[model samples]
Target: MPYEVQGVVSRAKGEPVSLETVIVPDPGPGEAVVSVKACGVCHTDLHYREGGINDEFPFLLGHEAAGYVEQVGPGVTDLAPGDFVILNWRAVCGTCRACRRGRPWYCFNSHNANQSMTLADGTRLTPALGIGAFLEKTLVHAGQCTKVSPEAEPAVAGLLGCGVMAGLGAALNTGAVGRGDTVAVIGCGGVGDAAIAGSYLAGARTIIAVDTDDRKLEWAKGFGATHTINSRGLGQNDVVQAIRELTDSFGADVVIDAVGRPETWKQAFYARDLAGTLVLVGVPTPDMRLDDMPLIDFFARGGSLKSSWYGDCLPSRDFPMLIDLYLQGRLPLEKFVTERISVDGVERAFERMHKGEVLRSVVEFS
Candidate 1:
């Protein structure tokens, strides 16, 4: 039997999302139905609402979520009803070229449930990030479910499903930040702060946080940033010089652009040492493009230039480990949840997020 749930839906571009009757069908083969526990109100949700992601209107908004398995469909063996889980969009197919090469995090072919949820009129709804979670329940591929320790709070744990995971992965996996290295993270939002935490955890000696907002920069310090730069009125060269001067005239060993503008991207490129790495974890609008930077700089940079996909994380591997860290008084995951909100409050949360007033306004299901 199908279930009718109150869900947040974006029916048109540049319009506010609203409560709708979303019909969630029973799990099909290789799929599972999850009773969503908590879903973080992420920016990506707002992006979909604004048609920034694609023309896939009537999007089922929300993704970064933690839930429990309510039902498992045919051919599902790894998960069963009652299991606590965090939903991940990347359900890697082991046969994909990247997976075959043992880099499932870079899986060439990830998957979602074959069945689609719909409106009362039978119009298909595109699930945001293929894991629409801002409702009572959601359906996803079985592989999208990652089991975590029961001790983890749903709101905190669900964050690893997206932004937080992306930030941590940028430092630990992509930038490969290590002991005594200097790391400068541009944009001290949720993702930037996570990168700061990751850098500190990875033993980075000096973590420099740069952002136009003094509030965000102050928050970055709580996440272990050793220094901060408020680039509000500063020019690109001044910001670059300020960052470079912090690291004995070379530059940071790694520079991460949590703000994905062409200027920030270029700033990140120029703000790194000759052999340093730069990680881009920020999402840009479709209209944003970059072609001004000289092509030779890519060759001269001498190290990695990478885009962090969900922090290049393997959910099954990182989820439990991060949960354990959260339990042990390390990896203060709770900090990410700036405020708790009801599902209906998501639209307001998006507005607050846009104003940079919150790190994560999580929708905690009752």
Candidate 2:
């Protein structure tokens, strides 16, 4: 029987999302039906609502989620009912070239459930990031479910499903930040702060956080930032100089541009020490461009300039490890959840997120 549940849906671009009836089908071959326990309200959901992702209308919102496997279809043996799991957008196809090369994290053929959930009227709804989870239940490719320690709180663990994972992977995987490295993260939102936390956990000697908001900077401090720079009214050079000043007249070993704007990217470009890595974890609009920088600058700067995709994470490996760390109190995953809201509160949560008032507003399912 198809399950009838309430899910947050964006019926049109720029319109407020509404709680509506979603009809989820039983798991098909290689699919699973999950009882969603919690889902985080992320900026990406807002982007989808505003049609920033694509013209796909009536999107089933909410992707950063954790849940229990309620049922698994045929051909699925690794997961079973009652398994607590974190949902991930990337479900690697083992036969892909990236996977054959033992780099499944870069899998070119990530997958979602073949079947689509629909509105009561039978209109197909696009699931946000392949996992529409704001409701009480969701359907996903079995591979999208990464079982982790059930001891971790749903609100906290679900965050690893997206933004937080991106930030952590930006430092831990993309930047390869190591002990004694000096790191600077620009943009102190959840993603940026997660980079700071990852840097701190990796034993960075100095962690400097740069942001326009003093409040966000303060949040960065709690995440283990050793220094803070308010770049509110400062020029690019001014921000770079402040970071250099904190690093003994040299720039940081790794500079992460979490703002993703051209200006912030430029700041990160100039704020790293010679041969230092620059990691871009922030998402930029399609209209944004970076053609003005002198071509010679790219040659003169002799280090890797990389963009992190889904934090370049391998869910089956990273998710369980992160959950273990969180359980051990070594990782402050719980700090990322500013508030737990009912499913209907996602619209208002977007306002709070836009105003930078909260790290994450998670929707808890009863």
The numbered model that scores best in TM-score is 2
lDDT for each residue of candidate 1 in 13-103, tens digit (9 for 90 to 100): 9998999999999999999999999999998888888888899788999999998999999999999899999999889999988999999
- The clash tally of candidate 1 reads 1
Clashing residue pairs, candidate 2? none
lDDT of 1 at 185: 99
Off by over 4 Å in 1: none
TM-score for each predicted model, relative to the true structure? 0.98, 0.99
Q: RMSD, model 2, all Cα superposed?
A: 0.7
lDDT of 2: 0.95
* Residue 62 displacement (Å), model 2: 0.5
Worst ten in a row by lDDT for model 1: 284-293
Q: Please give, for residues 271-332, the per-residue lDDT of candidate 2 as tens digits.
A: 99999999999998989998779999889978989999999999999999989988988899
